[model samples]
Target: MGLLPLNYRRPSYVAGSPRTMSDDQISVGSGGSGGSGSANGSNPPKPTKLATVVAGIPDALGFDRIIDGGTCPPCTTRDFMNYLIYVERSAENLQFFMWYRDYVKRFNEAKTSDIALAPEWTQAMEDDAVTRIQREQADKIRKETKTPAIAIFNGTDFEKRREVPKAPGSDTNPFSSPPQTPNDRDGSSDYVSTGEQSYRAQANEAFAAAGVKAPFTIQPFRKEMDRVIATYITDGAPRQLNLSDREQKVVLHALAYTTHPSALREVNKLAESTLRRQAHPNFIRWSICNGNTARVIFARVLGGSLIVVSTAIALALTLSSLGRGYRAVAAIGWVLGIATLIAAWKGMCVVLHGMHHHHVRPWELFVSEEDADDLGKRSFDSFGSANSYEEEPWVVRYHKRNLIRKIFDREVWIQEPALRQIQDTIFLQSMLCALLIAGLLTAIFVASPKGNFF
Candidate 1:
């Protein structure tokens, strides 16, 4: 109930729609903006914003017959341009949902150059080249550059002279524009993309020489991407990520030597090999939140609850269809609908998604053994635990650290601690709200309003 009002005044509502209002007390009209409990000018829904986001694409959300083949289909620059426009529009306009439906409709009907690559299969295709290059090009690079032999495998990240990044189709290799053969001339020492371990090590060395360690994620995300991509290709294909019977039977069902060694090492010590290898029951829809994969299971629970409540109200109205009060009952659905819409908008559904993935399920806290790739070594203890504050709270920790450091170093620091006080004020306001809601619900029956409109 408080969700609708609480999430109402948001500066930016990016995830979905806001929480719906109570069907019993509020009236959300048909006018645009869905009657968002706002008294200002009405604004329509922003569907395009929701659509552009790659997360939680509806199972029904896909092209009916997208082309796949020898020549890698180049995504239409125009369609991508439109998507960018929609993204920008959705970011600015409140009524962007009106435009969202049109964009999706355009996609299904129009030919888009932007091909949908299964996120899981990307690693395999990349590292295949890594291996290919290690065999064919590694020797050539060392002799030409006179530098240490730095092999660029079909690994995840590689520097491409091409403007658009991503693997070319098996037949349409993007490497052909100005083919990188073993015999190409020397003088180009910086051939590596920033994704490689050697590249980063070099970058870090340069930073150290300049007297600083750039605040960067020590995680070998590029290598991880490479490993995962390679596995997916071996497990299934570039077009679809559905693992084969063998892979599902073997890899998906059990734990093994994979991308995450440190985590596996710790978990293996705690659980038996059989249990450790058991498929993660809740891996169905987990995604990274600040580098930590947080499942949006809470939204599902809340969405389900709203649905049950709405169904009951709808049933009650049908039963009273012949009664004089039928009019009031008929409006009940609109009330419930608006309420659910509001809740969905407020990221309540996202919370439910989180809950579903974490509830009653034991999952691995380690990275998979995909580190078997030749390009690099996996960082130990990279994955953060489920309950660690090192996730989103890092921003706060940074502020706190800098604050204490200022006092310790005898430097004048006034910004962050003063900002912390403002945050505390907002926290107090939220506490007051919780109390107000409890008091209102408890006292509603005692203080009946004089017979008003009814």
Candidate 2:
């Protein structure tokens, strides 16, 4: 989520080994190369070029494009990260990278004194300060204004109290007819309370009344760094990274003195490079394969069968007593077969294209019922029920559908413009390829001798 540190440079290392240069050779001081040079009274050590984790993967298919595009769900969304954690069993690489990104952001934003605070703690403190300020402003406005402040309450509040009960036998309803309250002024009675707003307001008031602030200290950051090291960098950790002993030792040694972003630079580079060169390509390929529903796969197999059948039919027509023109009819089968194969290869379902919708991905459908319920609830809470992208209804509907229905079900719409464009391109390409293949087959059938089957 945060930009990588500009000062960070790639480290040189071999497979399953730490950097060739010793820790003494690299400087972690704030003054950069000059600090190292001043201390040693010698030229600063130059960075070494490290070999990539994997070599066969082409540069063009690297993760940079995905990160740049900023639209691919796998690279951008939590769902993909969930896939990596639950399905792929390689979550630490992503988890470490994500944590490091945030760490870099906090480190960059922090002052010298604030550097010792954990990033999460710093973020929470900032959020609390903002919330407190906003609440104070709202309270001040309410106190200054004689009339009820409509701006303080959102639409949901108005909806809940739209119809104020008229005072019995009263000529003028103070809170209703004359719009005495903000709720009566804006008519709607659909207020749904989750109690969270009231709790937050009460907590904010209590904090303000007491003039209390969360403790800010270096201990929290040090503890957080220790936990991070234990979980990721330390050997035999619960989610220990595939780092070499030397790499782990370097990070541990650096963190011994300070919790600065520079402390974990070596480990960060290793994790990032691993994800970029190895995990990312595998994720992309897996996502493509996983994107295809059972129906799509069936269609692909059927297409291959059609190709075989079409070839046999064309051969029969050519070898039989039928006229050369009759053999050209086989072009229709060739066209259908080629088109279907193309669609299959691209993982684009032709039926889903026309419907402008797609089935929930296989990983989504296969999640545990509890996870599905949680996902649905979160989706509903964040985006509401009317949103087409809401997950709850899709999960429920997916389970309710029979095998045949599931195969045909179109749940989520192709909402992303880029993805829609890709499908459109694939469809068009398939058509052209099919047409080309059909034309060639037809030409050969018509031009060949009556007995010729080639």
**Could you tell me which residue pairs clash in candidate 2?**
159-188, 159-189, 159-190
Q: For each candidate in the order shown, give its overall lDDT on alpha carbons.
A: 0.25, 0.50
> How much does candidate 2 score in TM-score?
0.53
Would you give me the overall lDDT of model 1? 0.25
User: Across residues 299-353, which tens digit of lDDT does each residue of candidate 1 receive?
Assistant: 3344455545645554444444243333233233333333334434332222222
Per-residue error at 114 for model 1, in Å? Answer: 56
Those runs of model 2 whose alpha carbons end farther than 4 Å from true positions after fitting are 1-75, 111-220, 285-293, 366-406, 451-454
- How far off is residue 240 in model 1, in Å? 30
Q: Candidate 2: lDDT of 247?
A: 47
Give the distance in Å from residue 89's predicted Cα in candidate 1 to where it truly belongs: 24
Best by TM-score: 2
